[model samples]
Target: MSIINQMLKDIDKRDKPQFGANRPKSVYLGRPLRTRRLRLILWGGVFALLAFLALSWLHERLSAPASDARPSAEQLQIQRVPVLISEPTQDAASQRADAETADASTRAEGEPEETRPRTTRGEQATVVVTDLEPTQTRAEQPVEPVEVAVSEQVQVPAQTSMPVVTPADTTVTASDDPGEMSIQRSGNGVGSADRLFQRGMDALSAGHNRNAVQRFREALLVNPDHIGSIEQLAAIQFSRGFAGEALQLLRDALERNPGASDLLLLKARIYERIDEPRAALDLLRGRQFRLPQDADLLILQGAAATELEEYTLAIASYRQLVSWRSDQGNWWLALGFSLERSGDPLNMQEAAEAYRRALQDRSLSESARNFALDRREALGY
Candidate 1:
């Protein structure tokens, strides 16, 4: 009985937990009987650290572009249009001031007056006009009349003592080449001038005179440096028989760029159209004028001289015109007329020779050819 009790006690001792032992007593051979929980904890920590690093890398990759300073290639191509704003003139200023002051009166009377844009006679708002069927988008926004920037440039004094001399009644014309008047679009598309200018040209081509004028004016408003818009606007005004307005715009352009020979020639032609031949001649003879061997200038000179009865000057100008455009029948016709009008016996013989040259041009219109023949008969050629 004692031996049985001793064997049970030994089994109980072997099953007890070793609380303070250096190694667990539950070991089988050289290894633990159960898996180590410490190993699992270490593996979990390693996996967690790897996941954190991967997530941080992804976050950085996504946010890099937003932190960059420079604009992207796509952003640089976006068109930036200008919003047009008008300054009230002196009379408009007085009216607005009066209206603002009358707020007290309105408060006392229990009535209010609506504010409105005021335009002087013949001046229209600077805006892009569409077809006869008005666009709802455009109609919703009120068009405000703006003072042209180019005109203001003309009024500015060049020096403190010497006031800028701008011809108040100036006018200009254009060259035959359509390309000479076209403004090229910019690479970066920074300004709205190109779009507005193109719209104006399209409107002009479509026979929408009002729309063309407004678009051109708006284009100039967007970029005051757009000389093409100013010239195009002036051309529309001239075609509509508003010669004075055309002249005013041209003078403003010339004042802004005094060195532009195209503007000078245009101004001379406008003077000729207005029947002021003397003015045309004087403009070409200005001190600031470059000595241009341009065909248009020579033709203008000859025509103006002929009109003024300056036969000697007319002869010289016509001779130069013939030198450049020998095929121009009108030039030969003018030369003959100038020589005949001189009334010199030597010029009379020269007039007969000039008439013979005019009759040789195949491109000359029938009316012009008949005129040449009549002139030749009159000159006893």
Candidate 2:
């Protein structure tokens, strides 16, 4: 058997014809074949992966909108309103520079030209704002429409320090809040009261509030009953954290013009500022002062009634508001809120109905519509 195996090995070595002595056949030949096959497989897989990635990136790029798409002019205007700045002319700038240089030279020389005017009045007492809320809404139940009082031509105050009357093409429409009044005047050929009021308004717009207050006062002195002066001055006082002063001023104006709805409403707003909603409501109380037809009065009544938990009155007032402006989704929402807070079982279905109606209004803002929808769903509508 050993002789036969030796003969078989000798025959296999002769037939295979070995290339190198002492070299392993498997290490040289088998390893190289296996490595070549593995390399081909790896390269194929890499190419396939790259192709897949390229296809995915191309698909994404094709699906998106073009990058160069632009908004319309109107859309751009709405999205980004431009702020205008006052530009002084070259002459004005030169004059200002010259004045500043003269001032600097005077200070450098230490020569007493003139003492700066100092205010004689001492520091005014600062009034702390009370946490009390005012009850009044803007219910100004006027006995009759208060006509604008016209005077025969009042003299314009001759103050050189007054701001030059620039021809501004701007027209500011006053806020239409219930307690507020609008003041409109032409930039050119306006009445003395109007011109002074305009100057005060300009000063206010410029944020020179002290100057604005002075101009308003001057306007009032020129025409004591100028509604514009009264409204603007009170507004400024209120803004300057002097709610009490504004209220008192409005009260004085009301005394002079008892039937002025604007004054009554303004006073009510001040009452609300001091956390006295009941007082605000009282201002509009009684059949003589019941201004059911007045939209502004109804709005104030609704707000004050709601604050006092007078749900029935609130509902009635809100309903009147809705009738006057059916397109106003907020009024409907207000009515719905009043109904829901009434705590009466009958009011539940009515509240749901109101919410549903509000939801149907296409003009309603997204947030308001969502709020109404949520309320309707919660009420099992």
Candidate 3:
């Protein structure tokens, strides 16, 4: 500090008194910068920038494999399908001996209970890493075992080397593969209706009418269109004096199968017994067109028409019956009986001719022949 002060005093003394305004002014000129020093600073900044970029690149490369090796927790959860994992098969005696030995060792060595592997009843699954690049860095390899312990998991039977069996009566399956599950009912269309029908028949033959009824009803439940089952059930109902119930049963069946011949005939008989002959006629009106050769339907239709004094309809039915079965004396007698009651002189003449045909039938009963003979005598033929 004293040296700088001495220099300053020497300069002050040399500037002895400048009393004149003509003293030269010290003009300011900027000092030039040192290019060498500036070059060194700029090179230092470039090296620092390059070093930063290289460090960042190395960091990203090191972290890439770690990211690829360990999947996210959410990904692992989604990939895990709950399944039962079975332990090795060990005999009971050997397992108990090993367990006792482990307990003794644990007690002697003061081993913590928690340090031993646990036996969990919870369902487990095996996770296998897949779909990775061939190259793997040692640092990226897993340091711990991949063991997932989920509290809530689906429980299933632990499978061994056994074939998987599908559920019963569940033949339906689905897949994205073509030519699989081609038809919905491809595997299960054979029902038990026939078997049930046979069971019902056995019961009926054994005089177990009530049991037979129940069996037939069960068969009908499985297959509503089971003709044999419905027929038997209807017969049982009508015979048991449940004419109304039988009628209802038959009507429900007819609703599904309007042209079912056996069901229609049974329904007509029920209607007649319940004093609904008009309903019977209406039910059987157009049925003849479809079942012209049905003998039971024709006989029932004829009887219903006669009860309602629909002699014309009755005569038509009997005429068709006689045409199909010329030797049926009852059918011939029915034709003559319907013709005589038609209240037409021309019909009376036809009645005599029909009665003559009835007498010619050897199959006619004694009473039926006598009735035909009296009708012919009264017709004055």
Candidate 4:
């Protein structure tokens, strides 16, 4: 009991209400200050964590380059990289080199490389081509150059050769070649008669009537009965307007040879030349009796009739001549002209037929055929 009493007494003293309330208030104030300090420490630790995370993000963004950070599709493409290894054996390398050289030589042979002018950034490359051969340049290039010759050609005079004449062996005296008879004999043997006749004929041909007549007379004196000389002389006299003299000589000649158609033609020519066409016609008609089928004589008669303006009779004569010598275009032309002048349609038809025949003749000249054709057209045949 005593121990219990003592403990109670101690407890009662310690367990007082006011003492208890005071002790609790002091403890609360001290605990409140410590609690606030702990809260501030916790908040500071959270802010430090957030600041460290932000600084780490800023460092990561500033450290990376823009191009390395974002790669494009082209940059993403994978490339095959070659790794250099050891070279091949010597024999294999030599064979490969030979094949490459052969290929290069073959390409060079097929298509030769052409040289072209090259230019750099600021300068141009100059190229010059020179011909290999001198003669080749002459053949390939088109250039005209003045030519110089080492020597010039010189002309020499030609040498001429002439014939040499010698003196004749024969010498004749005047008595040896005598008068007209001797002159005629000598002229005949040496063609002197032919030469004299040719001179006279030439004078007549040149229309020198007086000279022709004189030459013919001289020839006749050398030989009195020279027929050609006499006829020529008569023709010259007739041409000189001496028809009477021509007729006298022609008549005398005709008496010697009545059948001479040439003398008759000559006499008719003389008669016509004197404007006596009727007498010429009579003479031509008388000769026709002697020479019936003479085409030339008939042509002469046609010409004489034409001169007399007897166109019908002239056409008849020309027709007769054409019938005898069908190849003669002049006869046809004459007949056509005369018939056209006659104004007889029947005669005109006959004349056209004659010209047609002449045109068909191959032996006629082109001019003659054309003339006959022109006459036929003029006659309206």
Candidate 5:
């Protein structure tokens, strides 16, 4: 078996050529070579693109039109509104300059500058605004109205600085508030009086009652018909515990300006302040003092009448007041208060209704709401 294997080995070696020598493998590249040629090709592509772009830009610039800049006439325009002469010239500035030069020469010669305008051969006269003329404005100047308020506390009335000549019939109107009075003005010596009145108001607003009274009196002295001064002075007097003086001042004003609602309101307020409800009622009811239905007056009447135990009058006044301004919670409460006191049994139902309405008012004070609730429960409504 060994001899046969040796023989087979010899035959295999003889059949195949000897394996000692080697032939170089056909030259082969390993991985693809990274060469500078590739870099050169990339750089050439970029340079060609840049050259094409530069050529395109130069061509566009050369082909574009040249813009010619002509001078604009707008450069010579002075303003939208021109000052025209009686005979307008093409050169307005030159014409104005010549006029100014002529005026200077006339002044130098001490000649009265011609008052009349120099007329042209064919042109009509033009009214041009000169430096001496006032600025153009509306011809009529409306007087600032004096507004008086005495609802919660005494507020100083508005005053103006204008000197207006009082018309024979100066109209009086109610201002925006029912508590306010606006007097249309036409007056004389308006300067002194208006200034003094304004100063007095400032002083009063600053809590200087004495100084306010003094200023208000001075205003009255300057113009006795100064209603603001009179009213403010009277209010100060009354607030300072001078009831008689306040009443006397109002009385004198009422004598001059009869049926003045503002004056009447102030006077009635003073009377009420002094606890003279009957006097206040009389003043309000007087034929001479009758005024258009006023909320302040009506409320004053209700309060005064209620204090006097005149429930019927109070109920009437409160009803009217509520009718005019139902949202006023205090007015509703006043209506209920007066109704409860009214002797008529039929009024109880209405009184309870008023109480319920008072409770419905959000503006009603906490104390007032509680009172309304208790009264409503007690009345079984």
Candidate 6:
């Protein structure tokens, strides 16, 4: 029995169980139909869901109004508004054309009608009656007949009264004689000398200086020793920058007419222009002494002193000028400039004070005030 069991066990082991080894066999079966069916169903479900979403979107788009689909309220409102159609009016164009025609007619009346604008159609313009008024024929107005009245002739007595008349003296001189000298002068009936002088003045006014000089010389020849001509010639010479010639001429004239303040002042001006401030100062000082109340001479003297860098003397002269004409702002300005240049602190302060005084004067020009202010700023005051 043990032997039989061992053989059976060997057979069972061979047929049923191997400890660690097995024979090769097919592991796979054919694909299941239900798996394919499940795959097809899943794919169909995905496609159906996609088709359903697309159809839903199409239905939403088609079902909504076009205006509601837009996001903008203004665009929706614009779409909702109705458009208006306008018809053109011919009356406006006709009125414009009529106004243009009337304006052209007025302009044509202003100019010659032959020179007026022509129509391209080559049609002659006809006069159109704009107003209807009553017209009367000349024969329709009746002519009135004239009437005459005759009266009986009557004679009246005439009386003659004898006039008291003075007897005509044969020796009496006739006052209405044409040869009688009439000493009466009329308006501006200039003599030959005055006319020549006026012509020279006109030439001077017309800027013909050389012609003016010639005319003035002729006037002097007509009336030699004419002071006006001499003085004017000297002035013109000085204005032309011939100071030496002017000085000599004026000096000669001054010899004839001494104590002429105007000539003295003119000489002083020429001297100042020539850079001879000392001489100018001397002349102005002399004039000031002669005429103590001459503010012009005092101002001139101050200017000369200022030109010479004699600030103290300038201040003194300007002070005198200010005393003479207290109302003159230019004098105060001159005094300020002089004092400012003096280099003395006290005088500089005095100059600033003088400028302030000048600013208070109503006659001071804006340029003058600005200049004074500029000077004050420059002095660091």
Best by lDDT: 3
Candidate models: Cα lDDT each: 0.65, 0.67, 0.69, 0.62, 0.67, 0.64
RMSD of each: 24.4, 30.1, 22.2, 43.8, 23.5, 34.8
Candidate 1 yields a Cα-based lDDT of: 0.65
Q: What is the per-residue lDDT of model 2 for residues 1-381, given as tens digits with 9 covering 90 to 100?
A: 999999999988876755456566665778888999999999999999999999999988886656525433222211111111111221344334434544554464454423432212221222222222222311222111111211122212222233344334333443422322333445432366688899999998998999999999987876677787898899888888898889889888988987777777777877887899999988876523344435676788789999999988889888877776777788889899999999998899989988877877888899999899888888998
Q: Which segments of candidate 2 are over 4 A away from where they belong? A: 1-190, 286-294, 363-367
lDDT of 6 at 315: 83
Q: C-alpha displacement of 162 in model 1, angstroms?
A: 44
Q: What tens-digit string does per-residue lDDT give for candidate 1 at 199-224?
A: 99999899998898888887777666
Clashing pairs in 6: none
Question: Which regions of candidate 3 are displaced past 4 Å?
Answer: 1-190, 289-293
Give the count of colliding residue pairs in each prediction. Answer: 4, 13, 0, 0, 5, 0
Q: For residues 1-381, write the lDDT of model 5, one tens digit per residue.
A: 999999999998876665433433444343235456677889999999999999999987876644323323322211111222221111344434445544554464453335423222232222333222222221122212221222222222334344464543254555433423445555466776888899999998998888888999888887898888988888777777888998998999999997577888899988887778899987876333122446677778778888889888888888877776677778788888888888788888888889887877898889999998888888898
Clashing pairs in 3: none
**lDDT tens per residue, model 4, 1-381:** 999999998888888865876675655668878999999999999999999999999988888776466444333322111111111222344334434544554464455223322222232222222332343234444322111111112222223242333222212223311210111124332244445677888987897767777777777665555678878878777766777888888888778777766677778767766678798888876444323446666777888889778887787787677666777766777777787788766676777887787777777788887888788788676
Each model's TM-score?
A: 0.44, 0.46, 0.51, 0.37, 0.49, 0.42
lDDT of 6 by residue, 1-381 (tens): 999999999898787756334654444334576678999999999999999999999998888887565344222211011111111221344334434544554464477545644332222222222221223332233222111111122112223343433222112232332322223233322244455678888999999889989987876666555666777888899888788889998787678776666677777878877878898887666343433645567678778788889887788877876766677788898899988888888887888878877877898999998998898887776
Q: Which should have the higher lDDT, number 3 or number 5?
A: 3
Candidate 1 residue 42 Cα shift, in angstroms, is 83
Evaluated against the true structure, the overall lDDT of model 5 is: 0.67
Question: Alpha-carbon error at 244 in model 4, in Å?
Answer: 2.9
Better of 1 and 3 by TM-score: 3
Give the top-scoring candidate (TM-score).
Answer: 3
